[model samples]
Target: MDERLETLAQRTGQWLRTHGWRLATAESCTGGWIAETVTAIAGSSDWFDCGWVTYSNAAKARQLDVPATLIDAQGAVSEAVVAAMVRGALARSDAQVALAVSGIAGPTGGSPGKPVGTVCFAWGGPGAAVRTQTCRFAGDREQVRRQSVIHALEGLLQADTTAKSVP
Candidate 1:
């Protein structure tokens, strides 16, 4: 794991512990990389809830309830799909925070618009707080996946922090 990712995970774990929140994940291109990184810490079991690797579109629909029609219309690596993934993970788990990712992290899956390294991320919680982003990173397969995981952690940290500041 990158040092930055480790730091972000540490911060996220600390914040979740402070705020009495747990986290879940729904992953596609990065596999379970985000969950793996989160669980790397010794006591992460307290804050880390669960993770689902829904790589295939069918799996996304079956596991995370991502709509088949949405995947068919917008493909798997889109904001709508990732948002649905996050919402589904949040709904299924007892977690108060959720991160979801879908992407084309490869040399082959490049189309004109949605090229490789195009990753979509979504973070949501119990309240009306949901955020999403689309990042076009520059790297190989592993590099892109790693970057995606780091960004997901960063987003979680940001969300957790903002949620805390809300009076």
Candidate 2:
């Protein structure tokens, strides 16, 4: 619960409202922290439509329409999965903008290729090009999750900035 994070979320809300767009999130490792941050802002209901905590592959498939085959092929934390998650979030809600996050934020779950603190993010919107990013954070479980939430909010801001600058 960093105040700067709250400020970032507020800034994201301002931009979303200015653009007259709503947002939805499909979260995994950070649980619903991204959703919790946005909803903490007063009047966020105007811009934040909903959030799905698709922690399991089954839930991702069932709730967000993320294909099981994709997860099996790319793994849940991969960019492809996050991309599909963003699509699913956009499709499931009335939100015009969507963000998705999946990560291995743990003291465990570390592979040589995809270690703990490896978080993947994707952001997309109607007629807007999707953006994806991968980051390796250094921290414990709580710290990694906190960083993931911050990064997700930052992604929303960054995505909007990139989209607006395109034309």
Instruction: Judging by TM-score against the true structure, name the best candidate.
Output: 2
Candidate 2 Cα deviation (angstroms), residue 3: 0.6
lDDT tens digits, residue span 3-47, model 2:
987898899899999999999999999999999999999999999
Model 1, residue 13: C-alpha shift (Å): 0.4
Per-residue lDDT of model 1, residues 100-125, tens digit only = 99999997898999989999888887
TM-score of each: 0.92, 0.93
**What overall lDDT goes with each candidate model?**
0.87, 0.89
Candidate 1: pairs in clash: none
Model 2: lDDT equals: 0.89
